[model samples]
Target: MSNVILMIFTGLSVGAVYFLLGSGLALIFGLMRVLTFAHGAYLTACAYAGWFILRHSSLAAGPSIGTLLLALLVGVVVGGALAFLTERVLLRALYQRDHLDQLLVTAGLGFSLVALLNGIWGPDSRAVPTPPWFTRTTTDIFGAHIARGDFVLIGVAVLLLIALEAFLKHTRHGLVVRAGVENREMVRALGIDVRRSFTLIFTVGGAVAGLGGVLAALYANAVNTTIGDTYLLYAFIVLVVGGLGSLRGAAIAALAVGLLQQFANFYVNPGLGEILSFILMGAMLLLRPEGVGGKKIRLI
Candidate 1:
């Protein structure tokens, strides 16, 4: 039972990362109708950025809450900037194009971004030591050792989820974005700048992805050139399994995937464990094309 509880915590932590990454991808795809292959690239960039800050700055592993907060803030800003540029330079042009063209263009952009990241950060693995405050000690929970970092990640995920929900439900800017999603033509007719809403959505998505990167870098204790690649597929799977544009769906789907993956890894071979995630995703796709959550438009 203790082991099971431990696994659940671990799964939740991993799911938090997936939720963060997938939420962003889903938002971009849902609002802009652009399949952004560059999402992973943004995550990779953020990981590298966080790594650089931790290595060079006065930040030390463990309980440096202030430093972690600053790192996350930097991630949001940098990620937002990157998203804005990508939208302006690439996605904006492909908005009216066919899905195939958008796919190819975004795929190419992703490749370009990957190459750019490699050029700047090299292919070597870089360590991202946890803050001194976060690394203090592990707590025994039902005989399972839980790290403070894991709890922190889960807490952050919950807080972010709540915050996003509130923003989307109550905020004026969020209402505009939702309105645009439902009826771009109507939004434009109302003299609301739909494009601006798209840009905001993209920027917010990027920031979420960056937060995932930060959590991943700290959790893994290392960041590498291909780290983003590792989670990209999982993010897509989560997005698909969850309904597009549905934040609640994404969160629930992420938790399911995380727990499923953990169970597979524990009971099955690691290679097979990875395969199980796809199998489950495939089943979900076949049985329910709309995803686990039914699709509903908040706007007209």
Candidate 2:
């Protein structure tokens, strides 16, 4: 029972990061119709940024809660800035073009960003330095030790879910974003600036991804150039299963995927976690019964 509890926490911890990526991807594709390949790059860059702050900066001597907060803030800012540039400079012109063109452009940008990361940080993994509190388990329940870091990931993800839901459902800006997703031209005709909403949503997606990147490093106990790549595809699976433009689904699916992967890997084969996740995704697609192209612009 204790072993099982530990696995559950571990799975939830992994899923929390995936939720950040999945939710961000769903929100972006939901509103902008742009499946950003560069999102993983955002995660990677932000992780690097966070790592530098925590390890190479003035805080490196005696990192604490304040240091962690600062690192997370830097990561979020970096992610937002990168996303703003992508939306304004590269994606704005191609929104009206064929989806293939947009896909190619984003894909190319993602590759370039990865190359830049490799150039700056090199290909080696950097050790993530955590505060002592993070490593110390708060308590051992039935011999299942629960680390403080796990709670941090889980809590942040839950809070983010609530905040975004409130933002989209309650505020005027949320209304604009929802309307913009449904029909940008109609919103534009109403004299609402849908482009700003586009940029806003995209920036939010990037910002969330950036936050995830830092938390992910903390979760894994290390950082690497390919850290974002590690979670990117699985997150897309979560996005697809949850449905595009649906934060509700993404939230639920993230927990489900994370739990499934963790349990499967432990009780079954060592690498069966991802295989089972794909099976779950397939099951979801079968139930939806949508055409491939339709799925691209699908809101559900």
Candidate 3:
């Protein structure tokens, strides 16, 4: 029983990061209607940024909670900046083009970004330095041993999810975003400055991805140039299962996928775990067609 609990907790811990990444992708797709291939790049870059800062800076001696927080701040800022640049310089040019053009451009850009990362960080994997506090802390529950950091990761994800839901449902800016997702033309008709909203949403999405990168890196005790690619693939699966625009669905699907993957990996072949995830996704598509929380809408 304790082993089962541990496996479930492990699944939830990993799923929280996927939820963060998938929710960002869903937001960008739902609102901007553009498939951002560069998102994974953003995540990788931020992880690298955090890794670099923590390793090279004064914090390298013995990182504390404050040091980790600073690294996180750096990661998020870099992610947002990169997203801003991508939006202003690259994505803006394709707003009027069809989805195919946008996808091609972003895909090309993603490959280029990956190459850039390889060139800069090299092909070797790097580890994120966890603060001593995180490593030293542990708790026991029902005969199961758990790391405080794992719980921290789960807590952060849950809080962020709740805050985002509140923001979208309660705040004026979030309401505008939700409305824009539904009808960009209608929002523009109301003089809501839809373009600015687009920029904001895209930047926020990037920031969320960056946060995920940092958290995942800490959990894995490593980062690599290909980290983004791995997570990006999983993010798409989560988005597909959750529905394109539904944050709630992303959260639930992320947990489901994480649990499924972990359980399969433990009881079956590691390769089979990923295969099971895909099978689940295929079944969901055949049954729901529109996704778990997705509404039928014409993709423009």
**CA lDDT, every model vs. true structure:** 0.81, 0.86, 0.82
Any idea how many clashes model 2 has? 0
Model 3 TM-score relative to the real fold = 0.94
Roughly what TM-score does model 1 have, to 2 decimal places?
Answer: 0.93
Query: Model 3: number of clashes?
Result: 0
- Arrange candidates by lDDT, highest first: which order? 2, 3, 1
**lDDT tens per residue, model 1, 130-224:** 67657554867778877787788789888888988898889877899888877889988988888887888899899998888888998888998
Off by over 4 Å in 1: 58-63, 296-300
Pairs of colliding residues, candidate 2? none
TM-score of each: 0.93, 0.94, 0.94
Q: Which stretches of candidate 3 lie over 4 Å from their true place?
A: 57-60, 296-300
Model 1: which ten-residue window has the lowest total lDDT? Answer: 291-300
lDDT of prediction 1: 0.81
The runs of at least 3 residues in candidate 2 whose Cα sits more than 4 Å from the true structure, single-residue gaps closed, are 57-60, 289-300
**How far off is residue 291 in model 2, in Å?**
13
